[model samples]
Target: MTRTVLVTGGTSGIGRAIAARFAADHAEVFISGRHRDTVEKGAKEIGAHGVVCDATDSQQVAALADRLGKVDVLVNAAGGLPEAGPGGRSALDGLLAQWHASLAQNLLTAVLTTASVQAKLANGSSVISIGSIGAERRGGSYGAAKAALAAWNASLSAEFAPKGVSCNVISAGYIAGTNFFRGQMSEERHGALVEETHNKRPGTVDDIAETAYFLASPGARHITGQTIHVNGGAFTTR
Candidate 1:
């Protein structure tokens, strides 16, 4: 049966690919981004409905939740690198700004959006938040925020598990095809990242999208409060 799926930041990159994957499966997909033009364009391109809402803003998120009815799968894929602040700033101040931006963009976006749509989510619904490998290594402020996201998801899953809802985070590694690098990633850096992966290749948007699809499937109902790492065996805990 077709499910109602909501993907934030679905206008581009991994989020867009996820939306397209669901749309191809004939699911009713609703995508959101901060830009009206990009949102509409992406929706049209993927054959999914689009809405202009910034996941970082609680009010906009509430409006978005209201716009879309009950959602069976909610993918919080709205996050990225922190924006550069004022120049000539002290190291401590720079770090603080980056931390705040990372928390706001990566962690708080999911928190606010999920909270806004909590009531509308159906029982047995799946909540998937996009995370990064940085959370586990030398990711600095960005990684710390993602690590916080995983912690938060654990608590959220426990709270909502009784209601039959499942919550999880996907810790992705070396993923390409997104503005993740903000166009600053050098070819050498990219090559090094690819070389670090076991597959000797960069992760694709479809890889994460397919995993998300499975997590939201009936077979994955028993899975909750877990962090599924999809890094081409680049990093393994087991």
Candidate 2:
């Protein structure tokens, strides 16, 4: 059966790769991006449908849900380090802006998107939210938001798992080939991250894509409400 899969932030980075993975399997994939042209372009490249949606906005998210029939898999991949505005009137103002941006982009996007489409999720479906290792480390505001994402998933799973729906968070780390760093990643920083990994290499988008694919598979039905770390040993759980 062709799965009806939806991926937010599918224009680039990890989200794009996940969408492509599903599309390659002939799944009925739909990708959502905040920009129209970017969504169209990404959809064309991945052979999937595209919707213009800023996941942080409830109205747009509602419209997106209305457009879908049944969603077999919902990947809440809309999030990143939001760029701070030009200036802040005061120190407190800047802090507020940064924290708000972090929460809205990293946390609220997933919450709003999932809630809006909650009814559309089919039985035996999956809800996978993209998370970060920052939540377990020096993530600051962004990390705090991601940690909350996992906490929310726990409750979400308990509510949905009884109906054959699985919820999970994929906590990724040091993934390369994406604009995640916003062009601020220095070579020294990159090397330091890679050195900490067991494999001595940075993660690829495909790594997380494959993990997402597996978690949605039948083998992963018993793996709900868990945070699957894909950091290549950069962050290990004892």
Candidate 3:
């Protein structure tokens, strides 16, 4: 059967890479971005469908689910360390804004999207949410959000596994080719990250993309409620 896949935040970075991988396998893929032009362009290049959506918006997520009807694979890839917004009027307000932004962008986006589309998920379907290495150490607000994501995925997996669906999180580390650093990555910091990895290398978008592909495969049907780390051994779980 030709599967239907939906990947949120597929305009660039890890999301785009995952969408492209599935598209190459000839799946009927749908790629979404917060902007129309970027979504359209990404869809065109990858030979997949495109939709404009901010995954955190309930209405938009609902609308997207209505359009999808039945999704065989759902990848929640809409996340990042949110830019520090304009300073709040007060120190307390600023602190609140930063944490809220992190949770909304990283955690709630997946939570809302999954809830909106839960009914549409086909039997034997898979749900993959992108996570971060920061969740393990020194992540601040962003890391906390990803840790929450993993927790949520665990609960989601338990709920859906009985229905023949699997839910998992891929915790990525120090990927080289994304706008994730917001152009603020210094050479010293970058080198330090690579050195920590047992492989002494930065991860790539395709690394996560391929992992997403596997988790959706029949071989991984028994794997659920788990967080698979993909950081070139930067963080190990034993």
Candidate 4:
């Protein structure tokens, strides 16, 4: 059976990889992005359908849910570092703006999108959200938001489990191929991150995509409400 899979923020980076993996499985894949051009290009490249919707916008999310009909899998991958707002601001102002932006981008985007599509999720369906290992060690607004996301997923899983729908978070670490660093990371910092990993290497987008595919597979039906860390042993939690 060709399951319908929806991956938000799938225009690039990890989300794009995830969509491609599902498409390769011959699933009916759909990718969402804020830009029409990017969404069309990504969908064409992966042979998946494309929808233009900003995950953070409630109206757009509702419209997207309406357009999707019923979905078998939903992947919330639309999150990243907050963009800097207005210029020449005070230190305190800048900090507050960043904090709010982080929460909105990292936390609320997933929350709103998932909530909007909750009723559309079929029994035995899967809902996966992309998270970051930064939530464990980093003490910043982005980390805080991601931590909150995990907490929320725990509750969401419990609520949906009875209906045979599973919910989980994938906490990724040191993944490359995205504009995550915004060109500010130095070679020394990159090297240090790789050294910290037990494998002495960074993760690839395909690594994440494979994990996500497994989680949504029938074999993982009993594995809901869990945070699966895929960081090359960079950080372990028993």
Q: Which candidate leads the pack in lDDT?
A: 2
Q: C-alpha displacement of 133 in model 3, angstroms?
A: 0.8
Q: Per model, how many backbone clashes are there? A: 0, 0, 0, 0
User: Per lDDT, what order, best first?
Assistant: 2, 3, 4, 1
Pairs of residues clashing in candidate 3: none
- What does candidate 2 score on TM? 0.98
TM-score of each: 0.96, 0.98, 0.98, 0.97
RMSD of 1: 1.4
Candidate 4 regions with alpha-carbon error over 4 angstroms: none
RMSD to true structure for each model, in Å? 1.4, 0.8, 0.8, 1.0
RMSD of 3: 0.8
Q: For residues 1-238, write the lDDT of model 1, one tens digit per residue.
A: 6789999999999999999999999999999999999999999999999999988888899899888778899999999888899999999999888889999999999999999889988787999999989998989889999999999999999998899999999999988888888888899999988988888999999999999999988899999999999999888887
**lDDT at residue 181 of model 2 (Cα atoms):** 92
- If ranked by TM-score, best first, what sequence of candidates would result? 2, 3, 4, 1
Output the lDDT of residue 37, model 1.
99
Worst 10 residues of 1 by lDDT: 62-71
Model 4 residue 22 distance off true place after TM-score fit, in angstroms: 0.3
Residue by residue across 1-238, what tens digits does model 2's lDDT show? 8899999999999999999999999999999999999999999999999999998889999999999999999999999987876673698888888899999999899999899889888778999999999999999999999999999999999999998999999999999999999999999999999999999999999999999999999999899999999999999997
